[model samples]
Target: IIATVGNGMVIYIFTCTKNLRTPSNLLVVNLAFSDFCLMFFMCPPMVWNCLHETWMFGPFACELYAMIGSLFGVTSIWTMVFIALDRYNVIVKGLSAKPMTTKLALFQIFCIYLHGLFWTLAPMLGWSRYVPEANMTACGTDYFTQTWHSRTYIMVYAFFAYFVPLLVIFYAYYFIVKAVASHEKSMRDQAKKMNVSSLRSGDQNSTSAEFKLAKVALMTISLWFMAWTPYLVINFSGIFQLLTID
Candidate 1:
């Protein structure tokens, strides 16, 4: 589910090195934590299931694994979506995007993880319950795959977990790209206008550099798209099944 060893290293360095922190990179570190949380919570059972297709741990452990994995899984998406919004505000709205302030990014991080925990833990409280069931070959399924009442659980989980975050991600990036493109176009036009006036070589070089940097940022949006796309596709297929007749 996760990749990018190079960027991950950079995020790691930024997180541990206090001087390297910024709002944007701090968010990236938050993303790494979410991915690691998913790993710690998911990878052991997944490996066990693949090798033996049985739960070495009891039912309680299985439930705990599912709950923690799902929590961080959803939180990862929320982190990216919120980062997109922060980027938009910084670039387009001129708001300060630093991590430290009276108005801080930490509060937003708290909200994101808390929201994930609230939704994921709710099922254990009689809002929903895990049921014994099997995948095609007999591996037990997640709660959402277990029973009839699970439909409500799936709907609410997918809505809060995937759909809204996706909407926010697409919306924020759309504006961010637009704003960047607009600025680049304006710079090119201004450079053209200046070209007729016999400006110095240094100013023209600055315009070219600005245009190149804009292109890089535009290209990087594809990173976010790739990160979330596979998960979204799998999730949406599950959603589509409800409307299809067996």
Candidate 2:
């Protein structure tokens, strides 16, 4: 419910407020929209299934449910990757960085969705399969199968969806923090030379904005990882026979 309403409000405000429709903010809206889709479509049915003590939607519906969840899940991962990269560009490159434009933002968003669609559809295309989870109340990529085909998909998907993005986000934010710290030192040095308590205004707004966006990205990514990492670990353990899939 919180995810649904919070993300929905973000989407609504961004759509209605013209001033908030900047190119960089478009990425934020994309993130919100993806979360909105996942929470709106996936949660209600999942709760229903949980209450009913099984996935009453049948096999086909199970697959469809898992697909929708995976699709948006992948997209959200990449969206955060893009957000981190964008922050790196703005904060590290400063004025030399190319300004974000609506065209580029939309292009990137479309590509993110395409990448997500490809991965989610791979199971349907024989790379792997989606089946009811061990709990019987949810569906997900088949982790119980001992076959190499299914195990291989889980490995490759985890590499792309988890590790790759994790690395990218880490790299971007590391540089962003370094850049901000360097800028602060420079500002303090100049202020000392002029004998002012601090330098305020001008670059302050830009730095504040960068910090705000970075905070949002960090919080969202942190929570998302916390939510999903256990499931991912379970999949890996199952593939390796560390845990009985049944």
Candidate 3:
């Protein structure tokens, strides 16, 4: 409920505040939308099932819940990837260069949703199957099964939906950090050459913003990896162990 309301407020504020609308902020808006979808559509049913101690909505709703949840999950990750990339461009390329345009940002947002939907629909179209999870109260891709189909689906889905986006996010932040360091060094050198005590206020402000953004990216990716790494490892372990036994 808090997530839904907070993200909805973000969207509302962005819409109403013309100055808040920018190519970079478009990614933030998309992220808010993804969070809203996950919280609003996925959480209530999950909370109900948890309280009831069973799948109250039956098989079809279970599958539907899993689908929507997975879709939003992927969307959130890719949205973060895009945000990292946007920050990298702004920081590394310098904001005055206009690293992204409104049209390009819109296209990127569209692609993020389309990419998520494509993978989310694969199971429904027979790539694998969405079944009740081990807990039997929720549904998701058959991650525990060791069959060829399940393994293949898991591998492909993980690569595109998780691994690829994770790599992009890391890469973006890596470059961002490097760029920020280099800029700071250059500023220090200029200050030394001028025999000044410190950089100009504008330069200091820019550096502060860069560091803050870097810190945010670090925290976001770290938390994300922490949350999802166990699931990824367990699934892959199941896959590898099954293959070894076979």
Q: For each of the candidates, give the backbone clash count.
A: 0, 0, 0
- Lowest summed-lDDT stretch of 10 residues in model 1? 132-141
Query: In terms of lDDT, which candidate is strongest?
Result: 2
lDDT of each residue in 1-246, candidate 3, tens digit only: 898999999999997899989787898888899989989997788788889877788878878988998899898898898888888777877756567889999999999999999988998898888887656567788876768888998899899878898888888888888987887798899999999977769646855876797778679778977888887876687667742322
For each candidate in turn, the TM-score is: 0.74, 0.95, 0.88
lDDT of 1 by residue, 124-216 (tens): 876655433233211222433535556566667777877787687778768766876887677678779877544337755754553454345
Candidate 2: which pairs clash?
none
Off by more than 4 A, model 2: none
- In model 1, what lDDT does residue 215 have? 48
Instruction: Give me the runs in candidate 1 sitting further than 4 Å from their true place.
Output: 1-11, 95-103, 131-148, 196-246
Using TM-score, give the best candidate's number. Answer: 2
The 0-to-1 C-alpha lDDT of every candidate, in the order given, reads 0.63, 0.90, 0.83
Candidates arranged by lDDT, highest first? 2, 3, 1
Residue 129 in model 2: lDDT: 98
RMSD of each: 4.9, 1.4, 3.0
Which residue pairs does candidate 1 place in steric collision? none
